[model samples]
Target: MRLVRAGRRAFTGNADVLADDDHRAQVTDYFADLVRPFGAGPVTDLSGQSYGEMAKALVAEVVPAAEPVDLLVLAFSIHDVWPGRATATYLSHVCPGTPMSFAVCDQGSASPFTGLRVIGDYGVRRALLVVVEQGALPYESAAATPLAHRGVAMLYEEGAGTRATEVRQYPDVVPEAVPELARRGVAELSTGHPGARVVLSDSLAAVWPDHPDHTRVPAGQPMTGVWWHLAGASEDAVLVGDYDRDLRYLCFAVVAADQSSVD
Candidate 1:
């Protein structure tokens, strides 16, 4: 298993705060503690721009020469709602009139979100997106951008990609809300792959404890999804999301194992 913790910037408990050295240092320290158990070599110090860029850099630097692993733990957060793709975080965007946005990265100026896969062989090979918690209001897409959930609706509406995946959402903010994001993430996981196993996680293991480590925490269930690509789809493993914080701060387990085994 390979664990990687990356952050584009730091909030420093101050939403009004600006991005600067302190924020960078804070991000570094935060990721340092996060990646400690996993290994320093695999951890990347990305404190500016989108995590996708960091992902691009990390894969080129780390994954290429490293050994193969069963799973890759991705812990990334603080990306603008505005859409764009990258190595670390996935991108999606929407315009005001659109029914939904789309997950796009590779086709930055183009139409396809193909650019999302950055890692050489590790691109979409049985990956997982931690479904990290998002702020009440982070940012919005431009009027010129096509907007919606992962921007899938726009493409389907426009007949962009012939293939499409299904996702169902619940109403409640905690269990329902997080699951919505997880479902969307899982849909992204199933793209291009024939069959896949979705891995679940424990909410008790979330990045944040039951109580608030920060001043305010979102009220929701932890969001997580484990995707086994076409290669291991036959295993037919289902993984539930588990974490220390209940839907507050979520991340996938970097090490590969049945995360549901413990409390």
Candidate 2:
């Protein structure tokens, strides 16, 4: 499948508009027990962007109404303020195709890569991949959170084009093994696509193989960093990659410009 269209948006302020009093109370109670052990109170402050709302805004700009998708995947790391809602199902109904949709999470930054792999493995005619990150937490831990709220939507479809998107992921990759593994992965991905530009996450850049054509995404957006850059990439062939230190996952996606649209 080839990436046909892509768009992204950054969200600000709280998502209180999306939730009601009952919804907020339920979420607060749900996390009350979990935060007690940390000496933290229940999450009464619901100040984060809703994934459902963020995805809808992106879909509006990226996915065309005439070209409905068969699959919709939402990938996220940070929990949404309105977690009680079934966001994926809601998106499926609002999206043009009424496609089968689901959310992928607890995979750190690799969630989007995993979602893309699923789409390719399923051989769907058209699919929409939504990657989102919010900047709020009910209970605080040592884990890294997004500096800001952001989301990216990419529309992929089967087309008569030589440039197809490919996803690669390696699990249980320790820091010591990153340089070599990353080198091989990049070389393999760049074999056919000449002059492939490499976009690396901040963490990956520290251990990545030195490439003259590489650009490092700003830190703090663990889930959406690489994808945010991918949306604006100008290169015909670009390799977006990141290392999820918490999950020990090394993931990469090779996306090339849609040749069908080229004159």
Q: After superposition, how far is residue 237 of candidate 1 from its true place, in Å?
A: 10
Q: What is the TM-score of each candidate against the true structure?
A: 0.24, 0.92
Q: Runs in model 1 with CA error above 4 Å?
A: 1-50, 57-76, 79-164, 173-198, 204-263
Question: Could you tell me how far off, in angstroms, the CA of residue 167 lies in candidate 2 after the best superposition?
Answer: 1.3
Per-residue lDDT over 113-138 for candidate 2, one digit per residue giving the tens place of the 0 to 100 score = 99999888888899999999998887
Q: Which runs in model 2 stand beyond 4 Å of their true positions?
A: 16-19, 161-163, 209-212, 259-263
Best by lDDT: 2
Task: Give model 1's TM-score versus the native structure.
Answer: 0.24
Q: Please, what are the lDDT tens digits per residue for candidate 1 over residues 179-212?
A: 4455454455455333434434334224223321
Q: For residue 87, what is the lDDT in candidate 1?
A: 27
lDDT of 1 at 6: 15
What value of lDDT does candidate 2 attain over all alpha carbons?
A: 0.83
RMSD of each: 16.8, 2.3
